[model samples]
Target: MSASVERWLTLEGLSNVRDVGGLPLRGGGTTRGGVLLRSESLHFCTPGDVEHLVDVFGLKLVLDLRTRREIERDGPTAVARAGVETVALTFIPEDGRELPETDGVDPLVHIYLGYLRNRPDNVVAAVRRLAAVDAGPALVHCAAGKDRTGTLVALVLDAVGVERDAVVADYALSGEQIEAMFRRWTTASGEPMPADLTPHIPRAAAMAEVLATLDAEHGTDGAGGAAGWLLAHGLDEADLEHLRKRLTESS
Candidate 1:
């Protein structure tokens, strides 16, 4: 297995949980483990999974990207019962399209780009929350942890100077667990996997294209890319710096 896939945490209830740590930064280091993790929704977290997150990971906060309606439909998550503070920052606005209809472009790519173009404010807020000094060892999640979560993770990884390829690789790691995720979801919700989950499976090319587009449209002088996009939106130098220090370790 690839080193990236090894980062997956073995949880009893969740299938797609992985630390964003150990990814190479552009400067010369790896992201620190136990600092930033990404996962699918925690609504199905088993008692053991909750204990593992709380005891083993020392999870201090949860950045829930699921919308309020999703939470209501799925019922409460075990993270709340574990006493972890979950800040719900809905990345896609409530009325936003779940699968953006596009003619010639990857739907995931279109929706990701839409997040950057349409809901930049929400994206910035997620970064600000993650950068908070007190949010120790936080985990971020949406429904599948592939689209909304992946886009947000890409932005955070990029802002911290993580190499673009490494960022994309991490995003694509979700694809490896897509089948398991669907099965887990089906068991929890008592519904079969959606008729067409293929489109939702993450693709490295899609994330790469999105990053390239960010550099094109949001980058300053054709350079900044994700960091530039964040600064352009609302995050300042301090926010980026905090994220870098909190999540990375110099080798």
Candidate 2:
């Protein structure tokens, strides 16, 4: 991995920022550094944070997966103010309440699955931008950067032929940061902390179930998984190929 690429970025106002790089690719090599990133909301990013992302990361695009309501409540983020092109593409609603309750299902898992079944168009659009050649050093973020961002990043990684276990491990990293994120939000907003953060923390099993479900439902000859879902929804073969080439390089 390049010294310039950090697995975790300790920005002034963000807790869950990370470069989605340095993971082992399926056949060989690793994902390219500084090409892709994921994070929690940029809503509270300090000016220094913005400069670091822009100057150091050479960030060009921000794919925000937060609902418009969330943005209305808590943005325009410092990063956006710094002039990086930011696009809002929501994956699901603010919470999982709109989804029908299922017996014996983890609500988070149900919500993650709903993102795929309920909102395929948004998913394709986000993936398209990530695959675009000019979308240099892009970051995808939602409020918590766990559910919506996690699901989308998982799809991108899986589509790019990142190992499945690596994909799940990447998703699970958010769990480690989520508590601190909530606390930071509380400190910033002056709101009382929630008594329990269980609902907000990600469960590795949820992601595992989601990917396994994708493979079972969308897989062609047991291989397609996320790539198949993207193709079925609207992304073309060329975009998938471009995504692989764009995000990965020889180690």
Among all candidates shown, the one with the greatest lDDT:
2
List runs of model 2 lying over 4 Å from the truth. 1-6, 93-97
What are the Cα lDDT values of the candidates? 0.86, 0.88
Q: Model 2, 238: alpha-carbon shift in Å?
A: 0.4
lDDT computed for candidate 1 = 0.86
Clashing pairs in 1: none
Q: Encode model 2's per-residue lDDT on 208-229: one tens digit a residue.
A: 9898888998888647499999
Per-residue C-alpha lDDT of model 1 across residues 1-251, encoded as one tens digit per residue: 97876798999889889999899988799998889889999987999999999999999989888888998888778888768998888876787556556879877688888877777888899999899888788999999898899999998898787888999989998988888888876876799888877776788999999999888877775344988889888898898889888988899
lDDT of 2: 0.88
TM-scores of the candidates are 0.92, 0.93
TM-score of 1: 0.92
